[model samples]
Target chain A: MEIREIIISLFYLIASFLFIFGIKRLSSPATARMGNIYSAIGMLIAVVATLLNKNIVSFEYILLGIVVGSAIGAYMALKVAMTDMPQMVGLLNGFGGGASAFVALSEFYQKIGPDVAPDIKAAVAISISLLIGSVTFTGSLIAFGKLQGIVTGKVVKFPLQNQLNILLILALITLIVLAVIYPQEQIYYLTIIGISLLVGVLLVLPIGGADMPVAISLLNSYSGMAAAATGFVIDNNMLIIAGSLVGASGIILTNIMCKAMNRSLMNVLLGGWDNTASSSAVSGGKDVVIKSVDSEEAASIFDAASSVIVVPGYGMAVAQAQHAVKELMDVLEKRGISVKFAVHPVAGRMPGHMNILLAESNVPYDKLYALEDINDDFKTTDVSLVIGANDVVNPAARSNPESPIYGMPILNVDYSRTVIVVKRSMAAGYAGIDNDLFGLDNTFMYFGDAKDAITKLNNELKNM
Target chain B: MSDLFFMVYVFVLAGFVGFELINKVPPTLHTPLMSGSNAISGITIVGALVASGALHATEHATLATVLGVFAVAFATINVVGGYLVTDRMLKMFKKKK
Candidate 1:
C-alpha cells in the first residue's frame, strides 16, 4: 500500500475507536453531551480522510453539496421544537436511507456497459443496498407524515392489504434474483426499486400512530443495514464498521421498545392492536363511576401531600405542557413537597421522548425515574399526578385480562394515596379502550388541557 | 476470498462491540443514542464522495455524478442534522445540585 493509503487507514481506525468511546460514554448522563461531540469529531476525521482518496478527481461538487446540506441541516436542528423530535429523527433517517440507495445506484451506473457487468458479489450487495435503502427511505417518510399530521394517524387498511404486501415481497425477491443473474439488465434493478418502495409504504401504512416508535426504530435499523450493504459494494471497512455499529444500536432499541409494549417484533410489524374490537367491547360494557375535581380541589389535595409522582404521556406533548409541569413541580417543591417523575418506557411517541421534553423544561435528570425504579413507590406516595397520560397509567393493564393492553407494563399510579388525572375529556386513548384508572376509588379526574390545568393548579397552590 | 472473510470478521466483531456499548446506555439517553448512531451510519457519505468526485470514462459518467452529488448532500444532511439534534437533546439533561 502507498503511504497515503496507510495514513488514511490509520485515521479511519482512530475514528472508529472514537465512535466506540463516544457510545460508551452515553451510559451516564453527565458525559452524554461530550460523547455526542466526540462522535462528531470522529465523523469529521473520516470525511477528511475519504476526501484524500486518490480516486476523487474533483472537489467542486463535493464542496457544493456539503455547504448546501450543512445549511439546511443546521436550520432544521435549530428550529425544530422539542415536541417534534420524533418526526425530525424519522426524516433524517429517511435521508440517510435515500443516500445509501443513491450510492448503490451510482455504482451500478458506473459499472454497467454493453459487454461488461459487475461481479456476482457486487451485484448481490448492490441489490440488497437498493432494497433495504428504498424501504427505509419511504417507510420513514410515511412515519414522519403520520407524526406531523400530514397523514392520518389511524391504521390505514385496504382490502387484501396483507395479500398485496405478500405479493410485493415475492415480486421483489424475484426481481432481486433476476438483477443478480443479469447484472447488465437495468430493467430488473428499476423494478426492484419500485416494488421495494411500494412495500415500504405498505409496511408502515397499517401501523397506527401509537406504534410509530417501533416502526421508526425498525426503519432506523434498516437504514444502517443499507449503509453496510453499500460498504460491501464499495469494499470500504470504515463504512462497514460504522454501519454495523448503528445497525446493532437500532436493533437493541427496537427490541427495548417492543418489550416495553409487551409485543413481539412481528406483532408490531404486522400492525398493532389486533384485538381492538374485542378489547373495546369488553371495556365499554360497564359504566364505571368517576369522580371529578376542579383545580382548587386538586390543589388542596396536592397541598396536603408530602410526595408526588408526575406521569407524563403524549397528551402532555400535544398540550406543550412540559414547561407548565415544570412550574408545578417548582411550586410543589417550594412547599416542602418532594416531587419526582415516573416515565413509562412507551409513554410518548418515541423511546425516551418524555424524558427529553422534561429535560428541555429544565427538570433535573436525577429526579426522573424509570418505570421499574419507581413503580412500587407509588404505593407509598401521597399523590400521583398523571399529566395527559392514559393508557400507560391505566390500571386495566394490570387487573383486567380482557383488555387489549392487559399484558403491557404500566406505571402503578393507581396505587397512590390520591390519584389525580389531568385530561381534556373522557375520550379513549390511542388503543380505543377505556382507562380504568380514571374510575378507581382513589382517583380524581381533572378534566382540562394539561397546560391549562397545570397552570391553574399552580395558581391555586401559590395563593394558598 | 480471504479479503471477504476478513471483512466478515470485522463486521461481526464490530456488531458485537456495538451491542455491548449500547446496552450500557441508560433508558433516559435512548433517543440521543438513536440519533447519534444514526449520524454514524451516515459514514456512507464516504462512498458518495468517491462516486461524485471520481473521474469516470464511461457513457454513464454524468448520471453517476448527478446521483453521487445528491447522495453526498443527503448523507451530509443526515450526519449534520442527526449529530446536532442529538447534542441539543443531550444538553438538556442535568443533575440537580
Candidate 2:
C-alpha cells in the first residue's frame, strides 16, 4: 500500500529489464561490456530495494555487508588478469555457496518456534540452501585447488569412492525426510549439511583438470538454485526470479561449454572412463620425440601455400596472439589464398576458446566452423596451420584405443596435404599426452610464440 | 510453482539448449559472460537473508544470528561482485549496432 514500496518494486522491474538487455548484449563478445552494465544496474536496483524494505532487524550490518563485498569485487574486476579468470571464478563460487548455506542455517535457527510463521519459512529456505550450498562451496574450492595446482588435478578415484558417495546420498535423503517430519530437528540439519558437502567433493573427484570450466559452470548453476530456493522460502519474488534466471543461464552455459568440448554431462558428473585415463597419458618414458621449426623456415611454407586453415588452441590464448594470427589470415586471404579457421570443440581453457581468440581479432563468424564440418575439407586443403592447438587435433582421438581422448571427435588436421604445427615446444597438451601428429611426415613443427610465428609467416608471405 | 522454480526450469531447459546462444555468442564476450554469471550466481545470499531471525529457542536464535551475518556477507559479495563485473565487462562496448 506504500508509495515508496511500489516505487522500489518498480525499480526492481527496471533492474530486471537491464538484466535482460545485459544478457542480450552479452550474446556478442563485442557487446559484452554493455551487458555487464545492464546486469549491474539491475543488481543495484535490487540492493536499493532490499535497503528500502521495512522488515529489516537492523540496517548497519546490512550496509556493512554491502560495502565489504563490493570492495573485494571491485578489486577482482579491475586487478585480476584475464588468464586467472578461472581461478577467480572458483574462489568466487566457493564464497557464494558459503554465503547461501550460512543464510539457510541462520534462518532455520532464527525462526524455529512453532508459533513464528517467518521462522518456519526461514527454516525451510535454509534447509534447501544448505544442501545445495555445501555442494557448491566444496566443489569450487576443489576446482580452485586443481587450477592453482595446490591439489593434483588428476581425477582422484579412491577405492569405493563411488560407493561411499552413494551412502552419503542416502544419508542426505534421510536428513531431508527428518527435516520435513520434525521440521526443527537440529541433528538432521547438521547431518544433511555434512552429507551435502561430502557429495560435492565426491561429485568433482573424477573430473580431470581439463573439465574444470564445465564443473565451474555446473557449480555456478547449483549456487544460483540455492539462492533461488532461499528466495522462495522468503517469499521474495524478485530474488526467486533473478536467482532462477542466473541458475537457468548458468546451466545452459555449462552444457554449451561442455558440448563445445564434446563432453557429455553424465561423463562430467560421474567422472567416467573418458577423463580418468589422464594418468596413463602422462608417459613414464619420453615415448615419442618431436622435431621443432623456427618461424623463418616455417614462413616458406606459408609463402607457398594456396589454401591455409588456422587451427587455434589454448596456447594462442595464453600468449594472447589473436591479432597477430588475424594479420596472418588477412595477408594469406589477400594473396589469392583461402584462409579458414578450424575450431576444435574443447580448445583453450574452456569451450569457445578458439572462437574467442578469432572474434577478438575481428574474424568473421562465417569463416569459422566446427571440426566435423571442416575435417573432410582439410584433406583437399593445400595447407593446415595448427596454431597452439593440441588435444583437440591429436590423431590419437581417431585411432588409439589407449588414449584418453579416444572415441571423442577431433579436427582432421592430419588429412591436410601439409600440416604446420606452431607451438613453443613439443610438450603435451592440458591432457598431458604426447601428440603423435607432431612427428608425422607431413607435419612441420613451427616452434615459437604463435603471434610472432604467424607475424613472421605474414612477413615471409608478403615478400613472396 | 513459485517464480524461482520456474526460472530454474528455464535454466535447466537452457542448459540442454546449450547449442543455441553459445555458438551465437563470440569470444570477445565469453570471458566477461563467465565472470558476470559467476558473480550473478552469487545470489545464494538469499539463504542468509532468511536466516537472520530463523531459530527456535533463545540459544538457537543466537546461533542463527551469528551464522546469518556470514550468510548475508557472503551473498552480498556474490551479488554485488557478480553485477558490477558483468556490468563493467558490458560497459567496455560504448557503441551498439
Candidate 3:
C-alpha cells in the first residue's frame, strides 16, 4: 500500500476509536455532550479522509453536496423544538436510509450492463441494501408524519393489509431471486425499490399513534440494518462496524421499548393497533365514583404531604408542562417535602422521551427515578401527583384482565395515600381504556391543562 | 478466512461489541443514543463518493453522479443534524447549580 493509503487507514482507525469512545460517554448524562463531540469529530475525520482519498476523482460535487447538507442540518438542529425530537430523529433516520439505498442503487446502475454480468455476491449485497434501505426510508417518513400529525394518527387498516404486506414481501423475494439470476436486467431492481417503498408505508401505517415509540425504535434499527447492507455492498469495514453497532444497539433499544409495553417484537411488527379503552371489561369502573378537587385544595394536600412523586406522560409533553412540573417540585422541596419523578420506559412518544423533556426543564438528575426504582415509594408517599398520565398509572393494568393493557407494567400511583391527577379531561388514554384510578376514593382529579394546573398549584403552595 | 467469512466474522463480533456497549447507556440517554447512531449510519457517504466520482466520465456517469450527489447530501444531513441535535439534547441534562 502507498504511504497516503497508510495515512488514510490511520485516520480511519482514529475515527473508529473516537466513535466508540463517544458512545461510551453516552452512558452517563454528565459526559454525553463530550460523547456527541467525539462522534462528530470522528464523522468529520472520516468524511475528510474519504474525500482526500485517490478514488474520488473530483471535489466539486462532493463540496456542493456537503455545503447543502450542512445548511439544512444546521437549520434543523437549531430550529427544531425539543418537544419534536422524536419526529426529528425519524426524519434524520429516514434520510440516512434513503442515502444508503441511493448509494447501492447507483453502484448497481454503474456496474450492470446488457452484456455485463455483475458478480453474484455483489449483486446480492446491493439488492439487500436497496431493499432494506428503501423500507427504512419510507417507514421512518410515515413515522414522522404520524408524530407531526400530517398523517392520520389512528391505525390505518385496509381490508387486506396484512395479506398485502405478505404479498409484497413474497414479490420482493421473487425479484431478488430474479435479480440474482439475470444480473443484466435493470427492471427487477426498479420494481424491487418501488415495492419496498410501498411496503415501508404499509408496515408503519397500521401502527396506532400510541405505539409511535416502538415504531420509531424499530425504524431506527431498520436504518442501521440498511447501512450494514450498504457496507457489505461496498466492502467497507468501517461502515460495517459502525452499521452493525447501530443495528445491534437499535434492536436492544427496541426490545427495551417493547418490554416496557409488555408487547413482543412480532406483535409490534404485525401492526398491533391496540385501542384499549373501547372494551369496558373494567367491572370495577361501572359504579363511577370520582373525587374531583380544585387546584387550591390540591395545593393544600400537596403542602401537607411529606413525600411526593410526580408521574408525567404524553399529555405533559403536549401541554409543555415540564417547566411547571419542575417549579412544583421546587416549591415542594422548599417546604421540606421530598419530590421524585417516576418515569415509565414508554412514557412519552419515544424511548427516554420524558427524560429529555424533564432534563430540558432543568430538573435535577438525582430526583428522577425509573419505574422500578420509584414504584415502591409510591405506596408509602403522601401524595402521588400524576400529570396528564392515565394508562401507565392506571390500576387496570394490574386489576382488569380483559382490558387491552392488562398485562403491561404500570406505575403504582394508586398505592399512594393521596393521588392527585392533573388532566385536560377524564378522557381515556392512548390505550383507550378509562383509568379507574380517577374513580378511586383516594385519587382526586384536577381538570385543566397540565401546565396550567401545575402552575396554579405552585402558586397556591407559595401563597400559603 | 475467506473474504465472505471474514466479513461475517467482523459483522458478528461488531454486533456483540455493540450490544455490550449499549447496555450501559441509561434510559435517559436513549434518545441521544438513537440520534447518535443515526449519524453513524451516514457512513454510506463513502459508497456515495466512490459511485459519483469515476476516474473518467462515462455513458452512465451522469446518472451515477446525480444519485451520488443526493446520497452524499442526505448522508451528510444525517451526520450533521443527528450529532448536533444529540449534543443539544445532552447539554440539557447538565446538573443545575
Candidate 4:
C-alpha cells in the first residue's frame, strides 16, 4: 500500500521480465552470451531492491558476505578448466541449496520463542524449505565428489538401497506432518533437516560417475525447488518466480539426458547398471577380431577421405584432446575434406559437455551437429573418426539385445565407410561392455592417448 | 489465503514459461542454460539479505546473524560463480566463416 513497497514490487516485476527475456535469447548461440548478461543485470536490480527494504537494519554483515563470496566466485570462474565443468556446476548447485537451507534456518531462529508458536502456514513452508534444501545441499556435494575423483566413481550400492530411500521418504513425510501439528516444536524441524541430508547422500552415492550428468541435472532441479521453498518461507515473489523457472529448466535437461541414454528417470535415480555383470558376461566370452592401424596408416585413410565426422567422448576430455582434435580438423579441412563434430547427448559428464569443450577449442558452433542431425550422415561419410568415445558409438546398443547398453541411442559411426577409433587400448567404456564397433571389418583401431594419437596423425598428414 | 493463491498462480505461470523457453534452447547451449539458470536460482540471496540485516535484539540474534551471513555468502557464490562460469563457456561458442 505504501509508495516504497510499490516501487520495490515494480522493480521485482521488471527483474522477472528481464529473466524471462534473457532465457528466451538463450535459444540461439548468437544471443546466449548477451542473455546471461541480461540475467546478471536483473539479479543486480533485485539485490539492490532488497537492500532498500525497510526490514533490513544492518549492512556490515551483508557487505562482508558479498565481498568474500564475490572473491571466491571470481577465482573459481576464472580458474576452473573446461573439463571440470560438471564438478564446478555440481559444487555451485550445492552452495545454492545450502544457502536456501540456511535462510530457512535463520527464519526459524528469528521466530523461535517458548511462548510463541509460528503460524501453521509459515511452519509448513519452513519445513518444506529445510527438507528440500538440505537434500539438494548434500546430494549435490556427493555428486560433486564423485565427479572430482574425491569419492569413488563406482556405483556404490548396498542391500535394500531403494527400500532404504523409500523408508527415508516415509519418515520425512511423518516428520513434516508432526512439524505442522506442533508448529513450536523445533525438534521435528531439526530432525527433518538431518534425515533429509542423509537421504541426499544416500540418493546420489549409488549412482556411478557415468550417470553423474543426470544426477547433477536432477540435483540442479532440487536446488531450484529448494529456493522456491525458501521463497514460500519468506513470502517473496521474486524468489518464487526465479526458482520455479530454474526448476523447470533443470527438469527439461534431466529428461533430455534420460532420453538420450534410453533410460527412465527412476532407473537412473535407482542406480543404473544393475545388469552390468550379466551384460558384460555376454560380450566378454567372445574374442572379437579387430584391425589395428598406426598413426601413419590412419593418416592415409584421412588423406583419401572427402568427408569426416568426429565423435568425441569423455576420453577426449581426459586426454585434453579437444585442441588437438581441433588441429586435426584443421589439417583435414585444409585438404578439402569436410569435417564436422558429432556430439551425442550424453557424450561427456554432463549435458552439452562435449560441445562446451569443443567450443573452448574454437570449433565453429555451426559445424558441431547433434546425434540425430548427424547420425544419417555417417552412412555416406568417408571416414568417421571416433576420439576416445566408446559406449556412445558402440553398435551393441542397437544390435545386441543382451548388452547392458542395449536400446540406448548411439551415433551410427559403425555404418560409416571407414570407422577409425583412437583410444588407449581395448578397455571398455564406463558401462564396462565391449564395443562391437571396434571389431567391425570397416573399423580400424588407432591406439594411444587421444591427444598423442591425434597429434601424430596430424604430423603424418602434414608430411604427406 | 488470497495472497497464497496469488503466489501459487505466479509460481505455476513462471514454471510454464520456463518450460517453453528452455525447450527451445538448442542442445549446443544446454550447459550454459544449466549454469545460467543455476545463477538465477540464487535469487534466495534477497531472502538472505533480509535475514542478515533484520536482526532484532533477541536472544538468538547472534545465531541468526551467523546463519544469515553464511546464506548470503553461499548464494552469492552461486550467483557470481555460476554466471561467470557460464559466460566463460559461452564466450567459446564462435562461428567461423
The TM-score values for the models, in the order shown, are 0.98, 0.82, 0.97, 0.98
Clash-forming residue pairs, model 4: none
Q: A1-464 in candidate 3: lDDT tens per residue?
A: 99988887788778877878888888888888888899889888887787778878887888788889889988998899888999999999899899999998888877865566568888888889999999999999999999999988887777877788889999999999999998878899889999999999998888887788888888888888888888888887778888888898889999998888888877776666355435465544386788789988998998788999999899999999999999988899999999889999888888888888999999977778988888888779999989878879888789878777778999999999999999888777776777888888898999999988999988999999
Candidate achieving the largest lDDT: 4
10 residues in a row with least lDDT, candidate 4 chain A? A273-282
Candidate 4's residue-wise lDDT over A1-464, tens digit each? 89989999999988998889999989999999999999999999999999989989889999998988899888998999999999999999999999999999888888877666668888989999999999999999999999989998988888887788889999999999999899878899999999999999998998988898899899889889888888899999888999999999999999999999999998888878765475447576777899999998999999999999999999999899999999998999999999999999998899899999999999999999998899999889999999988989988889888887889999999888999999999987888778888878999999999999999999999999
Interface RMSD of 3: 1.3
Alpha-carbon local distance difference test for all models: 0.89, 0.69, 0.85, 0.91
Tens-place lDDT per residue, model 2, A363-464, is 776688777678889989888988888888888878886776676778889999889898888667766677878878888888888778777777776777
Better candidate by DockQ, 1 or 2: 1
Comparing 1 and 4 on lDDT, the stronger one: 4
Residues forming the 10-long window of minimal summed lDDT in candidate 1 chain A: A274-283
Better of 1 and 2 by TM-score: 1
Question: What tier of docking accuracy does candidate 1 attain?
Answer: high
Residue B71's lDDT within candidate 2 is: 73
Q: Write the per-residue lDDT of candidate 1 for residues A254-363, one digit (tens) a residue.
A: 99989888889888877788644764476777777999999999999998999999999999999999999999999999999999999988888888889999999999
Model 3 chain A: weakest 10-residue lDDT segment is A276-285
Interface C-alpha RMSD, model 2: 4.5
Q: Is candidate 3 or candidate 4 better by TM-score?
A: 4
